[model samples]
Target: MSKRPINQLSLFTPGLDTDPAVKATMREAARSCALSREQLCDRMNELAGQAGIRLNGGNAKQLTLATLEKWLNPLDREHIPSARAIGVFCRAVGSVEPLQTLVAPHGLYLIDEQQVRKLRMAEIEEEMEALKREKQRLKAGS
Candidate 1:
């Protein structure tokens, strides 16, 4: 398979608005790593449109990292993505250099489905505890 450029793929990343710092980091990664900007933009435009992300609002030529936090993540925002996210955005998901340069530096810790499951379980546990506490308080009052 022919390798697509970095700039092309990075643009499609969901947080065109949410994660600007990461976006700026991605742009720098593209330039330093020699990724294609135009192709990335094209792919980004296509995917973002499907996901209902506005493409033509702010910072036209470049993505602004600061504005990223305002919008909701396309899917789930709680846990950061793992290989799945990389598979969706990166040209090389498993490559060490890519992870070190493109993802890790930006504080995006990749989490697998197992990690997500654990987090969900933890959240459930917390909710259960809260409910139990509320029940105890009601019993005491009664």
Candidate 2:
């Protein structure tokens, strides 16, 4: 007997197209972030409490170690938090490492405050230079 073809809608899920190498790197990063010396679970709990994030319909006090375990454990792919939750966690904890890890495989990086300031400064300098050139050109034309 022949099996029916799967629908296109079912063929594409978020992260389904991620490269294997990238996925492996992300997994390693997740493991590292979860097991860091700072204790990710405790940090998450503290951050969640501070930020008023309710997990699994539970109050801040209800956010348990097991919930964090499910989030951090790379093997528990089925229970990983959504991307938005990851971003919220990172911001609440004042650490972009987790977000950086998640996006590194996609050739992207989340710039820190210092990096952002530097980038903006460079952009402003470039704009100033362009304006200077334009001024010079107009003067020469006149």
Candidate 3:
């Protein structure tokens, strides 16, 4: 029997827009994250009202619908918002979806507050169990 080269197989198709797998994954992420375009816009608008952010060389206390529409439009990929803007949106909405979407392709994940709390609790429980076992072992040896 002869072995086939790995490169001979088709690993990935080039066009993401036309690829069913890519589309399905995107749709699934959006659904699981429960983030709609309207909700995103509303969150962005709410964040824009705060005193710190500046957009396009002007102090925008609030972002206008026109600006937000341009940013949110699927056809306007070239004009998509910056990473900082996405971060602000995530913080404003209390959701990690935007950050996860941005970093997923790079093999990264964004941990939320609830996940952190759970992880910490697990660690504490494990440590307590270990301490109890060690105490028992020392008493037996004595």
Candidate 4:
């Protein structure tokens, strides 16, 4: 597939209020990171380059420290980062907390490979309980 600009504006409603917690999560992620903010942006850009991704407007630079600052700034809602930027930020900082924070308000969550099995087991247990209840109901009716 052909490469597309990563920062295309989609799903944004003008004048809509955004959750402050999203930016707070990003700030916490940055604070917990061992690398400085400049280093973090550099690493994000490097990763984007490796993935053959570029920001919108076909700009060669994927991210910069100033851009990153705007993203983390609570007052600068207009400078929101793209989904791709968030992904790279998570990868660079070695945490999914920001992503988790974004999805939590929607009743969604992120789970790692290790948690998949546990989730499946819980599902299976629920199904078994449902079946047992059905069997008892049938026996009583018979």
Q: Against the true structure, what is every candidate's RMSD?
A: 16.6, 9.5, 8.4, 9.4
- All candidates: TM-score: 0.33, 0.59, 0.52, 0.73
Q: List, residue by residue over 1-142, the lDDT tens digit for candidate 1.
A: 9775544434446543344343344444445534355555455445555655444454654222322222213333442323323233344222233344445433455576899999999999999999999999999999
Ranking by lDDT: 4, 2, 3, 1
**Predictions in order: lDDT:** 0.46, 0.58, 0.56, 0.76
The residue-level lDDT of candidate 4 at 28 comes to 86
lDDT of 4 by residue, 4-121 (tens): 3443333542222343566677888999999999899888888888988764334545676888888888677677777777788899899998788766544457999879999999
- TM-score for candidate 1, residues paired by index: 0.33
Error of 2 at 2 (Å): 44
TM-score winner among the candidates?
A: 4
Between prediction 1 and prediction 2, which has the larger lDDT? 2
Q: Candidate 4's error at 62, in angstroms?
A: 3.0
Candidate 2 lDDT:
0.58
True-structure RMSD for candidate 3: 8.4
Runs of candidate 1 exceeding 4 Å displacement: 1-107
Best-first order by TM-score: 4, 2, 3, 1
Q: Indicate whether candidate 2 or candidate 3 has the larger lDDT.
A: 2
